[model samples]
Target: MEGNMNYFEIFKDVSVVFFIAIPPWLALRKYLKNYLNRAFLTIFFITYIIATLLTQNVFPFILVVLCFYFAIKMKDNFEVLYYLRPIKEKKTEIILYCLFFRFIIYIINVFYASLLEYVGIKVKAQDIYEIFLNAGWIKVIFLFAMTVVFAPIVEEFTFRHILYRGLSKKIGKQLSAALTSFLFALIHYNLAGFVSFFGIGIYNCYLYEKYGYRAAVVNHFIFNFISVLLILLIKIFNIPTVMT
Candidate 1:
C-alpha cells in the first residue's frame, strides 16, 4: 500500500454535502427560539442553505466560532472550563487515565489500519502528516492552528457539546453517544479508518459525559499532537510500515 494518497480528496467527495450541511442546520437550531414551529424551521433552513452557498471560504469558520461561543454561553453550567479544575490528590490519576485511554485508542487505530489492508483497501497512513511535513513553516503554523486548535474547538463544541447534548434530550445516552460517534466518523470521509475514527469519537463522547467538554477537547488535542509527532518521526527517519 502506497502511503502518498491525496487526503484532500476525501474532503471533496459528494458526501461532503452532508458534512457541510450539518453545521448551519445544528447551529441555527441552537439559536432559534422558534425551532419547534415547523414553518419557521423550514423557512430558516432554506435561508441558511442560500446563505451558505453565497458565503466565502471564511464564513464556515466564522460560523463554527460563533457556535463555539454560543455553546459555552448557553450552557447552564460552565463545564467547559470547570471540568478540568485540578484536584491536587487526583491530578496524577487524571493524567494517567488520559494517557492510558489514548494509548488504547492508538492500538485500536493501528489495528484498524491493518484490518483495512487485509480487506484489500490501501491505507495511506501518512496522508495528513505529510501535509504538515511538506508545507512551508508559515503554512504549517496555520495548519496546526486550524487543525489542533480551531478544529478541536469547533468540532468538539458542535459534535460533543451541541449535537450530543441536543440528542441526549431525545434519546438514551448510549444511543446518543453511538449516533454522535457515527456522524463524527462519517464526516471525516475516510473509509479505511472509519472504525478507528468511530472508536476515538466514542472515547471523546465518554470523556465529555463523564468528565466534561474540556476533557474531550484535551483528549482530541493530545491525540492529534501524538499522531503528528509520530508521523513526523516516521517521515524524517523513513520508518518502514506494513505498506513499505
Candidate 2:
C-alpha cells in the first residue's frame, strides 16, 4: 500500500485554525479518554487556554520562569516535572552532537539566505519571508511573543510531550524519537524551515530522552535567542556569526 507522502502532503488540508483546538483534543486523547479522564481533560484544556490567554504578558513568563526555578531548587522533589517524564539524563555528548549539527545548518541558512536574496527576499537575521521586516517596536514585540513565547510552549507540548510520548508507547525509543522529530519538522510548513528544523526536532527529542522537558525548553530558548542575535548582528552590524 502507498504510505502517506511528506509532511506537507499530510498537512496540506490542515488549516491554521485547526491548531486552536489542539490542546483540548490532545488532553482528551492523552490524559482523559474515559469518562473520568475525559472530564478532567476537558477542564484542563479549558483552564490551560484561559490561563495562557489571560496571562499573555510578562506575568505568564514570570510564572513559567518561576516554575523552572522551583523545579531546579526542589530538584529531587519536583513532582510536576514528572508529568514530563522519560526526560533523558543530562549528557554532554548529545549537546555536543547537536552543536555540531547546528553549526552546519548555520552555513546552510546563510546559503539559503543567499537564495532568498536572489529571489528578492532580504536575508537578514530576522524577517518572516522577508515580508514582515522590523516594521516597528510594537510589531517586533508581537512577533517575539508569537514566535518565542506562545510557539515554544504549544509546539513542544503537542509535538514532543504528547506525540513523542504516544509514539514511545508503541515503538522503540530511538525509532519513536526519530519519527516524532521528522513529523515535528514537517509540520513547520515551509521549504526553508523543513530543511532547517528537522535536526532541531531530533535534538529536542534527544533532550526529552535525556533531561526531560526542562532541557528541551532550555535548548529551545537558547536556540531561538542565538538565532535572533545572530540575525540582528548580521543585519545591523554586517557581521556573520553562525549558529553555535
Candidate that would win on lDDT:
1
* lDDT score for candidate 1 against the true structure: 0.65
Off by over 4 Å in 1: 1-93, 238-244
Number of clashing residue pairs, candidate 2: 7
Please, what are the lDDT tens digits per residue for candidate 1 over residues 139-233?
77676666666566567766787778778879977899899899988777666667767877888888777777667777777767766667557
Best by TM-score: 1
Error of 2 at 81 (Å): 3.8
- Kindly list the per-residue Cα lDDT of model 2 for residues 191-232, writing each as its tens digit: 555546776777778777667775676566556666655544
lDDT of 1 at 181: 90
TM-score of each: 0.68, 0.58
